[model samples]
Target chain A: MTALDTARPGISPTAAASEVEAQGRGGGGGPSRRKVGRVLTWLALTALAVLFIYPFVWLLSASFKPRGEVFDNRLLPKTFTFENYIAVWQEAPMALWLFNTLLVTVLATVAVTISSSMVAWGFAYFRFRGRKYLFGVVLATMMLPQAVTMIPVFLIWESVGMTGTLTPLWAGNLFGSAFYIFLLRQFFLGLPRELFDAAKIDGASNWQIFTRIALPLCKPALVVTAIFEFQAAWTDLMRPLIYLRDSDTFTVPRGLKSLVDQFGFGGEWHWEILITASVISTIPMIILFFVGQRYFVQGIATTGTKG
Target chain B: MAVAADTSVTDSPPGRPPRRSSARSRETRAALLFISPWLIGFAVFTAYPVIYTGYLSLTDYDVINDPSFVGMENFRALLEDPKVALALQNTFIFAVLSVPTQLIVSFFLAVLLNRAGRASGFFRTAFFLPKMTPPVAIGILLLLLFNGQNGLINEALGWFGIDGPDWTTDPVWVKPGLVMMSLWTIGASVVILLAALRNVPQELYDAARVDGAGWWRQTTHVTIPMISGALFFILIVDTIAAFQSFTEAYTAFFGSGNTTYSNDAALFYAIYLFQQAFEFLHMGYASAMAWILFAIVLVVTLIQVRVTKRFVYYEGEQR
Candidate 1:
């Protein structure tokens, strides 16, 4: 039941080897067949890699191209120009949006990390009446669809006159998210009980043990939590769309959405600016992913394998 | 002698007989203190919103006026609404198409990466990069790549001597186009399934081979069962996500407030709910739609759990 509770919508993979296996079997048998199989596998993988990476490559290339050559489908831009980037800055509030996104993302990420780790520490370290029930509730929240919560949560902020303000975006994260708490709790539980006992014997209070011992020891998990939350907040559009009515208050994704509206769909047809803004918004997250690649993989791997 | 000495010495201090209970209570207090943030958040953000939404579903709410009690009126309207049916149909089609495709593609990619061994690291990073792209950006890319005429996708298809449909403009092709776009972010799934694949002991494959199992047999019997738990987790998660998919579709079709595109084709349940709650100010109707979505998801998830229980192979668990 608890495992089911933690089932937030995510991604996964499949297995079927009929044609490939047949191909492997048909080849000049034994070692030659094995060699053929390996080559085929490499080919398939490389082809898929290109399919996956091409859009970003195209987007990047298009961003540097002039408006006419943007969709020329060539890997290299025929006429490379940074004019789109230059004009994007002048046309839209890109810098202000970036700042707003950074502020909200930082606040949300930091708040979720600290708060979730603290809650996780409680779940991991303590044995109390109703503890299981409390943890169950935490897990259960993950199962609640955002659609169910969105309107009422918006109304709550609206009632408080926090709508159209950046406060609504990060304020809820101060309470900690269920998924992070669960992830951090798993990390916390892996810590040996003896460490806390030793700290207690050394006259360190529970709070002292939590701050000084648990947190530092769980740095990798903390980094994972921070990275995940940072990405989530940075890319989050729904909350911003709901709460942020003004252009100045919009986050990067929200700003990008507006740019898509303006350039791609209805407004003016300066698509190069939209493409430029899209690339600009994507780079930070791409850099973050590279920097925290190890932790990110480990964290996602644990989520799948553990529960 | 040590056991006798320990029993004689007592665990507590000589003058502190009640210390154990006090210490237990103190620890409980400390635990509560630590988890208070989650508790506060749960009450306000989760618990309250859920209950309030339920209440709002029963009323006529327009955000400007007070929510008046109009018991089940919104739910009744939801039953009569043609758009509700259309939205649900769109969402269902999307989930049906995207979830299994995602699972299969990600699994296949994971298998490829798993076999790649040392070279897997670079490929895994390459594959996972797209998952890092912002949803809004993905939406923009979707419009650009799938742009019916003179689009990169159509141009690529032209090279293969196949004509492409007007993906953004045509109603029939819109959902399919969205599914194609969804495939770009299967990186997380691939990484997850790869982890699961790596966890499958080599002994199982060796044993299968010894028993005369071929590559296909080994994959189906040994490799798949070993990773069924992870696969099941992904299935449930992806299904729920597919149902709730908002950002990319919203950004692509509805974000611009453009009436040119076939918006009905992309009118997903969550998107309609958004339109109702925010755009149309039909807060009560949206709340009702939300509850219906919740109920539908709950039933679907429960069905999945029941159905997969027999098939999912949790290691060391007794049959």
Candidate 2:
């Protein structure tokens, strides 16, 4: 068993043994039968894993193949070349798109993380009137479908003359998303009240206590919130699709959409470049997942169990 | 000790009640100050927009002209629009098929991972990497893999002597193809259900075994009930998400200026709504569509909560 087993209780070794035994041949299986069962389970899992991972592997390999060889269905490219990756930049403004996506993602992630944690701290720490009702409003916002607000929110940005710019994509995040606020509030509530009380008695102002105490204590949650928001901002296509009319302002997903339009069916038929761009766009997220695998698992577990 | 410390900060000399109230008010003020961002955001982004959507639905307003009141006209048009019905039907089909399949598949995947011991982490990561892929990328993958001819999926099917249908070009197979693509991201649900599975009490399974329950019996009786909460949560969430499915289908079928594919089969409700509001600039009609969708989601979610309450076993609830 790994740290995950110990972190979560109830999945002891004997329990696992019993689980395997229960899954054995009708509770009267010999040791050989159980061993066969284990091998079959492993084989089944390996096949499923291959099914899940093969497409990406194909995409990754296809990115390196020559244009006509892109659909040849070989996992290994017969003629490997880096020309696709080199040509992708010349064919499209991928560098600008990457820069735009990075900027927007950073701004949006920081804005949402700080703003949501503050609001969550207020909800979790303070005893204020109408707190329950206000928090209910936050939760209710989570239920309200974005389709309902998509038009008017667009109109709001249009009226402000920011629709054609990148402002509409990241600006709304300054207000703190309801989902992140709710998640952070759970983290804040898990904190002991005495930490803040001790900070209070030491003459720390509310802001100082929030910055110095609550923020530090909830670093894992903060990181989770930031990473979640980063992924949201980076992968978000809808907001950019609506707001960005100019290719210059396009994020990676929007750029990828345009690439699909250009290459897939718009008669360019350059499948290699399109596949390369997809691989390029996917690499950062995969890398982040590997680096932050622990936090990702922890964050997902908390959201599931706590909810 | 923490309670005593907490009270020490709030405790005042008995004669000074006004000071206590003032301190309480100060804390309240600080709290409000801290939460002011959400307050302002709620009013601007959520509250105002929702109320305005309600008003907008009743009028025919293009972007250039002021919204003129046509009360009930937009709603009436929605009823008459054939595309509206088609979109709704398509969305319903997608949701009904996708949600249950995703739930069951993810549950079993979680159960398998739960028993995989040392190999669980690698399998989980492999499964979850797809979920982390951007939806736009997934849309591109859908096009690449599900293409009618020479796609990887069809090539793989040919190995088993089964010819795959033209997924993107054929109207009948479009939504089913999308459902298959949606399963690629079941890793999230699997992770959630795995967490729930790990928390299930071992004794319940032991007791079930003592009663001579086998794998399927113990699963149906003990394992499922223990993780029913997570299952129900994924059901509601995935249902909502399925209704809002746009990015992938849009990118695959409609994102390009080219519309030579089977757009009708892929025209999900949100995609239709998006086209009306953004592409055609029919703000009022789209608003009306939005409200209808809102109502449908609300009703479906309510029905789910009410129906699942009996079956979902909360650990500490009074039986």
Candidate 3:
């Protein structure tokens, strides 16, 4: 099921070609024409793929190159060195920022996954009063942009004396994210209701049924949610900028922003260090994407098609 | 709500009324208990902030002092605010140009990927790499790539006997630069549309072909209608994302010492709002701008929903 198969989709290219083959055998335009067409298509796709992947290659190479060679318009570095990476580490608080980000992303991902799943189970299992209305509330929250609530949310956190701390950043996720809740709710709704009924008949509490049955059945969805929350927390720049006050508290994104400010100014071009810091910040996410690309694509596919 | 309850009661055969009632009440209690976290979150984070923003829009609240009731003064000022008008214009241009362009490009790429045969997995992974890159990192990369003299973009254009615009320095290319950036991460929409295309049944295509429809005709008549729901989904999501575009414009144009006069062209709606609230400390004015943005988004969404009703084909709706 998870093999990333094109088998189920309508008419795979090879399948269509075979159908052409089966029909009239040598009567139709021969297989050579189709072979040429396939070759051209692959060539075009390869070029497009290179267009998409070139930036990362450029970023990685530029990060290792000397300052003068930064904008040399070359794919490979002539004289790559570790000096920029070393400079980035020694000159900036990269380790501290990474630690801060790891702490926030892990905690917030766990919090959002737990809270969203519980709420999703509620909306999925129950036929309560105002259930649809509450789901509408969830949908509305998704539409309400952070820009709309920026000032007042900031004020609320500030009034509570938590502005300069990381509390305001991850604390919001503990409440439940609308997107995660909606995603999990869709997954939960697809689950068989008979399982819940069976658990209930066996004298299982709602909590027990949720912990034992719903959660176990929904591991894929949970993984998707965790990946999403972790990515969001890790890549977030605005929230950290707004909430964090000191360099000691800066996340990777905010710290990287400061790096640009500090080194990318006043006729002093530090592109190597800047790019190095960016590459370092991006490595974890790239790793995460490669590891969980299937889940990520599945989540996007599910959310998109279901909508 | 009452209709569902009444329907359930009427639909029941007989002799199970009390049991159903107890079961329903039990479910309701369990539901409330399970969703308590979200309810508290909704009340604190969503519900209160919405109402509070409305209240703040009516007053002049600086961070240091209590707000004074300003009535429509901020709104009145907003009408004459050039920055507000400029930001709105820039945002409108962005959404109008970028959304359709992105949709077309993503759909085209999706079609290519769909036809990619066995190479689909490798191509999918490669294309999706950009979307996975952090915006901060992308900003830095773009800044270099789009640099006027030595950037790779212009260098590539030179090979085609074309003089590329100074993407970072010129005011004329500022919004276009942002638009280009927006298109670079078209993977999300591609994935969505790919899934949509996969969901399109094979019988529809065969039927269309049997009716003498060519590939283009089949795509237009059958495939598009089938996937209109996903198209509309990307439309709304991308529009909202475009309006709130900040990190790229902020990081690429306005970071530290690179803030030139032309950088004003990159002052998007959210970037402007950030300036007002954080840079200038015009809390009340920024609040008013935020409300206007909210109203614009709400109206746009309602309009899209109305338009979708006319054109979008939901599969289960017909039956």
**Complex DockQ per candidate:** 0.42, 0.51, 0.50
Native-to-model Cα distance after best TM-score fit, residue B62 in candidate 2, in Å = 1.0
Where is the poorest 10-residue window by lDDT in model 1 chain A? A1-10
lDDT of 3 by residue, A1-307 (tens): 0011223355565676555343322325566656665676678889989999888888899988988999997888999788899999898988999999999999999999999999999988888999999999998889897877888889989989999888888988887899999999999988999988999899887789999999999999999999988889999999988888799999999988888777775347688888899899999999999899999999999999887
Output the better candidate (1/2) by DockQ.
2
lDDT of 1 at B40: 91
Scored by lDDT, the top model is 2
Docking class of 2: medium
Q: Over 4 Å off in model 2, which ranges?
A: A1-30, B1-16, B317-319
Model 3, runs deviating above 4 Å: A1-13, A20-28, A265-267, B1-22, B255-258
Residues B68-115 of candidate 3: C-alpha lDDT, one tens digit per residue: 899999999999989888989888998898999999989888877776
Task: Tell me model 1's lDDT, rounded to 2 decimals.
Answer: 0.86
Better of 2 and 3 by lDDT: 2
lDDT per residue (tens digit) for residues B1-319 in model 2: 2343356556645666655676676778788889999999999998899999999999999989999999999999999999999999999999999999999899878887876767889999988989888999999899889988999999989999999999988999999999999999998899999999888876676666677676778788888888898888898889889899999998888965675655899889999999999889999999999999999999999999999989998788632
The model with the greatest DockQ is: 2
CAPRI tier for the interface of model 3: medium
Q: What is the interface RMSD of each candidate, in Å?
A: 8.1, 4.2, 4.7
**What would the TM-scores of all predictions be?**
0.92, 0.94, 0.94
Task: Name the docking class for model 1.
Answer: acceptable
Ranking of all candidate structures by their TM-score, best first: 2, 3, 1
